[model samples]
Target chain A: MSNTTALPISALHERVEAIFRKAGLNAIQSGALARVITAGERDACKSHGIYRIEGTLRTVKAGKVKPDAVPELVLQEGSAIVRVNAKCGFANPAFELGVPALADRARACGLAALVINDCTHFSALWPEVEALTEQGLAGLVMCPSYSTVAPTGGNKPLLGTNPIAFGWPRMGKSPYVFDFATSVAARGEIELHRRAGKPLPEGWAIDADGNPTTDPEAALAGAMLPFGGHKGSAIGTMVELLAGIMIGDLTSPEVLEYLGTTTLAPPHGELILAFSPQAFSAGRPGDPFARAETLFEQIAGQGARLPSQRRYAARARSEAEGIVLTAAEIEQLDRLLALGLDAVS
Target chain B: MSNTTALPISALHERVEAIFRKAGLNAIQSGALARVITAGERDACKSHGIYRIEGTLRTVKAGKVKPDAVPELVLQEGSAIVRVNAKCGFANPAFELGVPALADRARACGLAALVINDCTHFSALWPEVEALTEQGLAGLVMCPSYSTVAPTGGNKPLLGTNPIAFGWPRMGKSPYVFDFATSVAARGEIELHRRAGKPLPEGWAIDADGNPTTDPEAALAGAMLPFGGHKGSAIGTMVELLAGIMIGDLTSPEVLEYLGTTTLAPPHGELILAFSPQAFSAGRPGDPFARAETLFEQIAGQGARLPSQRRYAARARSEAEGIVLTAAEIEQLDRLLALGLDAVS
Candidate 1:
């Protein structure tokens, strides 16, 4: 038998959705979660793909997230803010519920913000931003995770690996997009190194005694450092202020305290801002989309790769050739579909 | 003779305003410019203080900026975007003219953006964000300067240093604020290194041929690197897109092409976003400001320094003891006020 089995993207989505539904997730939650996970697999972003299914089930088993959440959208007259209360469910569904209104508000206001509160978040932000680009709008997305990274110059973990993502629409091409954690390295990277018994590169983390260290174990026990020293640290702090407190949601430390462990998905709030290029560039000379092409050309002409190129390329391939899953992955999926929540622990 | 002279902040502002007025700037432009420059000096940020006045006059003398042009505000009913057409003047006055309307719109809409177009921008962004903080709002400001930094993995200068600034209001204290260039090192830092006969730092810049170089002169002839590698580069690129192309203003490369030299200030548009915490945290559990204070205390408890602390400390001293200027600086100010635009080549 072949070591790998190929499945169409739609087929994989159905399987994932089945597993979530079997685990008692509501239709909205299961569908949205499966879609994001399937998109992750299609883009060759394995970290967020099927690998995340177990964690999702574990969180469900632990009762950290509501299995049947019905998100409610709140739209105010003459306001540029679109809000969605997730009712303690997964953030994906809340985001899905809010995006259309967010798009409408952005079109009307030139720029608008979508705030999703009281949600369990565990997916990459790129999908949220990518959705805006699909609607011909530029978008930025941010949210706080569980606290795991230290502010620069601090000895303990107080800041999360708060991720920031940005997307810009292009002319019949993949939108320019980038999503990255403010920390020097993700906690998973350190965890992988610890499992492999490898040492971390310098500057990634500090020891428990507040000294720099290379040992992955010590670094994991201590704290990961913010990227680019003070500059990245400041950006992370801004994320806490804007996406956390400003949104009236739980900050990273609060999420950690609520969950009591890093294994569970974080319950917090997310901020997504959308901008209508047509509205902003209405009186301007050049078409914003065409002008953006020129900028990308200059960047690529000089041999610099645009962000999200790799993921887009993988997406194209996956669409054409189907996503290939290893036999072990197939077995894992089968077990998940068969056992549901009982499969996790 | 004493090497330095102490002057009240108001006195310094008057002297600076007088210099601009003599240089042929309109009353609005001169007054706004003087206030920002004086604020810089009061905070001990010498780079943007009196040191920048000469450059402003140089830009004026070169006919790159309008000295006497008046900025006009353009407001559309029910829109969150408050625009100011700089009328080819300095950005300071345009920003000053739009801030009040911006604040009002933010309060009404929960969030708002102020766009200043067609201006010569040289002053630091902190003052702009700080102005929003003074109104009890959180603010974010960004603008594109001349292209001097290279996109990561690219050999040539294709992006600006692209500074980003953010400020959050605090109760009974200076706002939490940070402003920084996306580049690993500012162009001035490289020029200073060259003047001091010091080699450039590693990872700071690339030679004209695209290879890394520690020689300051070679680096100056080449391109500076973005901080935090690809992440910073993505942010710098985003600035060019949102603050530049999206706003229908000049991008970094376009600014460089228009000016043909980095010595002259770049004329571009700016984007300022203001968010209302009261509107955002309407029915949330804890007070956002108090929660932010908790976050700050946790950071400080771990021995981490908050951004802008030093500047705030200096500001307190300047307010209490008056601002002190070096004798040489005083003489320069006198010469500029006396000679006006004729002082520059």
Candidate 2:
């Protein structure tokens, strides 16, 4: 077991921002990156939080990801569709430009869709979706990555554990957010278990031969299973075509074949949709936000819990008591701090 | 075992059309209904074929579904966003108005989305999607219906076995079409088994208490399972929100609780999205369809067959020879044919 320590949210954000600054990211990029990373930690999404810092930093160091790059609007028409040439690393600029643009279009068209190709990995899609809900729009987002999974009953990895997220604005509470990968388990989870020397749960992964296995090491060397079997496989496959092929990027299988080839580019594609409530019920007198609140209250009254309830609860607790960090993670931070000092030498 | 007979596609279509006409449908509506039904039969999708005729006719007779209603575009903005009232049923007018509207919008916005609410049941969605591909647009469609499925690990049905479909254009061949329900097994499949006096395959359904069962009757009395278990369940749940709740319609629980209420309305919603190749690659500069065809061919050449290959092959055979109907189905049709004579009396 690792020891735990508490740090104020603001303090953690400042520290992260400082590190990014030292790593040569511009002020705006560092600020945005800090905010995204802190939000993930507060939401208890450890897999997408600071755990990704090292990998991101390495990409930056290799000049493979540009922190200062701004995304360009490739196409736009009415309030229905928009396309972005995502020149920056995926997370910050995408949130800065894509979400607001799509929401604006939705406001005008009553429905809007944005497709962004050539974007790097965007962390914890829920934040981006929630941002749309803040603008009183419903959001649905899907991102397809390079293949990290095999089709159900197949021996070779042929798709990514592509993630899909949707957010619906509710009345007085946070929007109902649902975000998950199509795989039985995510690659991060397998890595976490491997690092901790723990076994994986059944149905989470398969070996190279397509036989189930609980060994994390074997799982890393093989493929993650699609959650729910064939249906999950189908969903993941659909995401590949919708977000990848539709965007004119590499399909899932092509991404797999190009994996680990430094000469090959990162897999990329994202689709975001926003909907305005006015389109469906034009003259309903009630405020949509109020109606949303009433509906959530009714469901809660019936003891039917909404998804994202726990995440919000976790955020509240973290705000009150400060964020908790494992001793191992803190040690890694200390190592990074030392690296900062060594860099000056 | 039941005897079966082969009938030419045109004959089957005509017979089905006659039944609809006798049931009070106008010429265009009856023709549309007949074509979709016959197409299902030709593709061996018995569940969505003639088997649905009786239920559909009852809906029309009860005045719950409009027979001659034509969908009207209530809103359109820059060809990127559209709202179709679906004044009649979902399949016919939606195909007639929704696809063309979406394609035009996609051309303007690079992407387009259409929402069709207040529509009646639409049979297999693949054909409608294929229509979009024929217009040189990528199609993604989803429809959520009244509750016919229980949540994973839950007893009460809280969602429809919602289906999703996608179509991608290829050169010199038919478009790649994929359509499937989010359920482990469609309700129609279980109903078919019950009619044939056969046990259902395991893992397809659960009883009222949420325990697995293979009895078709029990499965019907219970709820169908989502495909791939939790992952499929998640997708189905997303569809319920995206196509149903987001459209401001009745949710699954609400529909179930108010099923027999005088104010009850159809609990179904659909979302159709279109993406222009120009949006991603600035049109077919080097033959986009040809490129897509080559990509798929190369993949298949490497033994990676695309989904829906077998279904398309079967459809071709049926068209070339004739559609086959079981003895029970033929008897049902004959009984319906006799109804026309009785109506004249």
Candidate 3:
């Protein structure tokens, strides 16, 4: 036996939505969360897909996150900056409500930013920025989550992995999406290595004493190192300034108290910035799209491909057939299914 | 002999200004170019300091750059997005006129962007971003210069080193700045390595055949690699879109035809984004400054230094004790000084 099973993409979304609803999320919350998870799976981000649902549900059960809390619009300046008060709930719902408006503002004003506060970020940041790119806008998003990283020179861990995601709308293809945590390897990747009994590549993490280590467990016990050394660390700090301090929200270090040891519902902040190319253009002959197409040709002529190009390829390939979950993964999902509806219990 | 000479900071600026004026630039153009070059030296950016003067002067002399052209404000949306047509001239002059207004607009509107098209960005990006931070605003500036580096997996050079610079306004202190070309090392660094006959670290560049090489000469003959592989490549692409494509200008490769074999005045675009934290803040009890102070403490506590911390340190040291320039650099500047004034000639 292959020891794997394939499920339809629609079934996956419905299952995720049902699970969120069963855990008592409101319709908007469940749908928003489900869409992101399904999209993540379709994009081949197994780290954030079906694998993350249990921990997300645990946040609802622990009473740390109010699953049905509707986000609030706290403040705005002109049409360029909008601040969303997430009311200590899932971030997807806030993005769902705020991003389209932010894109509209960007369309009108040339640029706009949506600063989200008091939100529990449940997964990767790609979906957040992709929303804007889908509407022919360029988008950049950053969020500072729980601290698990050390700054460049020190042994003490005082920063989060701090993922940043960006998307650029193309002429007719999928938007060029790029998303990554500032760390050399994500915490989940390291955890996977440990679970698989494999060692990590050098420079990924450190031991409890903060010396470099390839041992995933020891590195996890210590801290993740920022990618590209000081440059990545600086970007991480910038992320904190934008998503945390500028948004009047908790920075990675400041949010430590709110983080549960096992189940997490840390009320982090996310900052989304959108830009309209047409607004920046002077109505010139060689507009943005024409220039982008030239760049794409040049990039493709060389062996190097665009970021998230692989994701699009995987997505198309998987959608044609389906993705197969390993036996262990199936077991994890089955366990959640066995729990049934909390309302029934 | 030490082969180095120490000159007063004022002398450096005056010398640079004299060279520009001697080459037929107007007063504003001369002063703006001089200020940026002097600042590059004071800030210890040796690559762009006196070394870049001749190439800049050549642009003015060759008629590639309009030495006296005034950049026109072509378009603006609301108060947030300002697009400047650089009139086929030097960018510093345009930034000199546009940045303060852009900062004021950002202060009023919460976020603002200045998009410049048809200009030669001839100096370090730090000065441009620091302009906003000096006004107590956060700033990010990106520009696409001549193409030299390739995408991550490709050997063909399709993108510029593509510098990205950022600055954060600090309370009662020099603004924290971070600037780096999104490459394993800047092309300038590679040239320096070649001049010094030094070997490169791994993953820096690929030789003509697209195989990785540590030899500085081979690496220079080939294409430079992106910093942190694909993540940095994506950032490079994003910069091209924002600074080149979105601004309705030529992408890096598209501008390459105008570049001379030795001298460069490739007209490119620059994108400047500014954010006013005060505008985003709700005036809560714990203001943004307090959070920044707390963040500084955590950063210091963890023994991690902020980006551009070294530059500020360098500037302070250089200001106290005059910076020493190499004999070669002095010779280059002295050659221009020997030419005297164009009107006199």
Chain B of candidate 3 achieves a TM-score of: 0.92
**Per-model TM-score (chain A alone):** 0.99, 0.87, 0.93
Question: Which lDDT value does model 1 have at A47?
Answer: 91
Residue-wise C-alpha lDDT for candidate 2, range B1-345, written one tens digit per residue? 349888999999999998887877777678878888898898887767897787677666656677777777755434355677766464566556666667777787667777776677657888778888888888888877667777665676766778888888875677877788888887667988999999998899988667789999888878788887655776676676666666655555555564442122344557787877656555212444555665555435534457667778879989888998888888888888768424321
DockQ-wise, the better of 2 and 3 is 3
Q: Per-residue CA lDDT of candidate 1, range B1-345, in tens? A: 389988999999999999999999989999999999999999999989999999999999999999988999999887889989999999999999999999999999999999999999999999999999999999999999998998999999999999999999999999999999999998999999999999987999999999999999999999999999999999999999999999999999999999999999999999999999998888778999999999999899999999999999999999998999999999999999999999998
Output candidate 2 Cα RMSD: 3.9
User: Higher-TM-score candidate among 1 and 3?
Assistant: 1
Candidate closer to the true structure by lDDT (higher is better), 1 or 3: 1
Q: Model 3 reaches what TM-score against the true structure?
A: 0.94
Model 2, A75-98: lDDT tens digits are 433435567766646546655677
lDDT tens digits, residues A260-288, model 3? 45246567788899988888875765768
The prediction achieving the highest DockQ against the true structure is 1
Q: What is the TM-score of chain B alone in each candidate?
A: 0.99, 0.85, 0.92
In TM-score terms, which candidate is top?
1
Categorize the docking of model 1.
high
Is candidate 2 or 3 superior in lDDT?
Answer: 3
Q: How good is the docking of model 2, by CAPRI class?
A: acceptable
Which window of ten consecutive residues has the lowest lDDT sum in model 3 chain B?
A: B336-345
Pick by TM-score: 2 or 3, better one: 3
